[model samples]
Target: MHYKEAKHILSASNGMNLYRGCTHGCIYCDSRSTCYQFDHPFEDVEVKVNAPELLEDALCRKRNRCMIGTGSMCDPYLPIEKTELLTRRCLKMINRYDFGVSLLTKSDLVLRDLDLLQSINARSKAVVCTTLTTLGEELSRIVEPNVATTRRRAEMLKTVHEAGVHTGVWLCPILPFLNDTEENLRGLLDYCFDAGVEMIMNFGMGVTLRDGDRQYFYRKLDEHFPGMKERYIRAFGDSYQCASPNSAELMKIFQAECRAHGVRYEPDDCFAWLSEYEDKQVAAQISLF
Candidate 1:
């Protein structure tokens, strides 16, 4: 890991990435695509050393409180964060300013900040989003070798929800001919329902391949699923959206299950939940008898 002094911490949309690269080793990470233009190696994490100060300054200037988001471009809880506390410092700033937070990650290391998360929720809002690719742990290990497995993430979700912090699951990028199966979808949804997740975000039952990410994914496929990369080349050619042949049937089942469980399935709805900020004072006033 290396440190870089960032000029600004938050994006126009109030999202920030404290780090620029990841070490999770997830084969399908779109952040590695050539379009993102990382000057450093994907594993050479670039830490924004001044992220907390920048974020506090940004929040102070905001006229209205809205969720400050992170983990869209890079995972905040990378192993380096165990000592750096960059992400934790930003969370403390958000909490101190009474702003809400919603973060996405594949690491169970989030449990370490339950104190901050619970405090934020008790004031405004704090939603944790975890990605659930497949239920089978062995397959998950093959694809996301360095990150927490699916089962462990589910356990983390359960603990977060029990602590009164709303949680969501990103059941996404279901690699075709790999995890794109009805059984896989059902098992993942079962974990969400069991965890009482407020929402389940799924783009489709297939993956998108770009110049940088496609080559890396195909390479991993060649290494593990032999002959599968050739199948993808033959089937998808150069299309960006490689929808699974089973997308329609799987989506039908997904919709039905989400409705039955009352879990939000629409992307916009889940995103709205994450973005909406609450005024604790107004909420407290409304609850008074």
Candidate 2:
């Protein structure tokens, strides 16, 4: 990883990616898309040296204390974070400002910030969003290699919920023929529900493939699933949305399960929930006064 001084940190939407590229090595990472236009290799992992300072400035200048989001474009708790502590520093800054945090990652390292997350939740909203592709550890290694396994992520979610912080799960990009089965869906859903996630986002039970992302995904398919690349090309030649053949049945089960379990499954509702910020500490202070 290389460090560089950054001019700005937070986006207009209050989201920040402290690192440009990732080392988690997810085979289906959309961040590798050509649209993002990375100057260096995807694993080079550019570090924003001034992320904490810039975040402080941005949060201080904000007229409203909304949710600060991260780990969308890249995993904030990458291996580099063990030494750099940039994600931790930024979380501290977010806590210092009493702003809400809604982070999405596949790493169980998020558990290390339980103290800060609990404090933030005490004062304001602190939502933890983790992406779960499959519950099979072996399959997880093949796809989301280099990151925490599925079971470990579920444990992290349970830990966060026990700490009184809200959590959500991103159930996505179900590789058409590979993990788009009833068994895979049920295992993933069971993990999310068992962990008591506030939301389980399922956008059509499919994956989106664009220029750069599609090429890499197909290559990986060829490497692992042999002839799967040709199958995909035959099924979705040049198409962006690669909805699984089981998407219809699987989505039916998904929606029904979410309804029975009372978990949020609507994408819009989940996004709205993430954007909402509640200052419970201020309310409690007002009550005391």
Candidate 3:
């Protein structure tokens, strides 16, 4: 890990990635795509040393408080976060200023900051989002190695919901032949239902393969699945969007399940919910005054 001073922190949409590149080594990680230029290796994390200060400044100067998002390009609760405390510090700033947060991660390490997250939710909105790719622990280890297993992430969602914070799940990058089965989807959806996830975002039962990420994913496939790389090449050539043969069928089941369980499955609706901010405490205080 290396620290560098960043000129700017938050994006126009109020999202910030405190670290560039990820150590959590998801085999199908899209962040490794060539379109996102990285001067260093994908595993070599780049830390924004001035993220907290910049966030504080940006939040203070904002004309109105809105949701602050993070953990899109990289997981905020990566192992380094425990020591560096960059994510924790940013959450502190968000809590101090009473700004809403929509943080995404696949690590149970987020539980460490439950108090701060609950405080933010008490004052304003705070949504916890995570990705669930496969239900099998062995497959999860091979696909999303170095991160928490799917079961653990589901447990984290339950913990978050119990704390009275909203939770969402990203059911995506479903590796075609590997985890696109109905049984896998059912198992994962069951976890979501039990965890009481408010919403789920899925872009079909498929994965995206671009220049950089494609090559890396193929290499890993060769290493683990053996001959799976050739299968993908034969089926997809160099196509960017590689949809599964069973995408239509799987999506039908996914939508029906989410609807049955009252989980929001529409991407637009989920995103709108994340972007919307509500300050219940402030409203109540004003009402009292």
Candidate 4:
């Protein structure tokens, strides 16, 4: 890990990445794509030492309160966060300013900030999004090695929901030959249903592979799923969108399950919900006058 002073924090859409890389080591991480242009190794996380300060300044200057987002590119609750507390400081800033927050991570360490999330939710809204790629722990270990297992992430979602904070799931980057099966889809969907998630954002039962990300993923495949890299190379041949053969069937089941459970499955709708800000304190704050 290394610390660097950041010139700014929030993006135009009100999103921020407290850190510039990840430690979770998900084999299929798109952030590893050469497009991002990382000067160091992906594992060598770059911490934005001034994230919280910049966030506070940004929030203070905002004319209208909006959701503060993180963990889209790098997990905010990385292992270093246990001691660094950068994510915690940012959450405290969001809560103090009574702004909503929407964060996505594969680490259950998010639970540590439940109090601040709940506080933000009390005045506005806090949306916690978690990813579930495979159902079994063994597969999770092989694919998302350093992160929490699927069951643990499911448990985290349940706990977050029980805390009265809105929760969502990203069931994505489903490795074609590895986890793109009916059983895997059904099992993961059951976990989402059980957790009472408001939405499950799944573009499709497929994965995208580009230069930097493709090479790393293929190497991991050779190490664990022997010969899988060759299979992908033959089937994909430098194609960015690697759609699974079972994508159609899996997507059918996904849509059916979401409809039956009344969960939001549309990507646009889910994105809208994440960006939407609700001010629960407005009424009470107005009453004070």
Q: Count the backbone clashes (under 3 Å) in each candidate.
A: 0, 0, 0, 0
lDDT tens digits by residue: candidate 4, 154-226: 9999999999999999999899999999999999999999999999999988999999999999999999999
Worst 10 residues of 4 by lDDT: 278-287
Poorest stretch of ten by lDDT in candidate 2? 201-210
Angstrom error of the Cα, residue 258, model 2: value is 0.8
Across residues 200-224, which tens digit of lDDT does each residue of candidate 2 receive? 9878877899989888988888888
lDDT of 1: 0.92
Kindly report the root-mean-square deviation of model 4 from the true structure over all alpha carbons: 1.5
RMSD in order of candidates: 0.9, 1.1, 1.1, 1.5
Give Cα distance to truth, residue 199, candidate 4, Å.
0.4
Please identify which of the two predictions, 1 or 2, would achieve the higher lDDT against the true structure: 1
For model 2, the stretches where C-alpha displacement exceeds 4 angstroms are 285-289
User: Residue-wise lDDT of candidate 3 within 1-289, one digit each (tens)?
Assistant: 8889999999999999999999888899999999999999988899999999999999999999999999889899989998999999999999999999999999999999999999999999999999999999999999999999898999999999998999999999899999999999999999999999999998778999998999999999999999999999999999999999999999999999999998899999989999999989879989998
Clashes of 1: 0
Note the Cα lDDT for every prediction shown.
0.92, 0.91, 0.94, 0.94
| Model 1 regions more than 4 Å off | 286-289
CA displacement after TM-score superposition, residue 112 of candidate 2 (Å): 0.9
| Model 4 spans with C-alpha error above 4 angstroms | 283-289
- TM per candidate comes to 0.98, 0.98, 0.98, 0.97
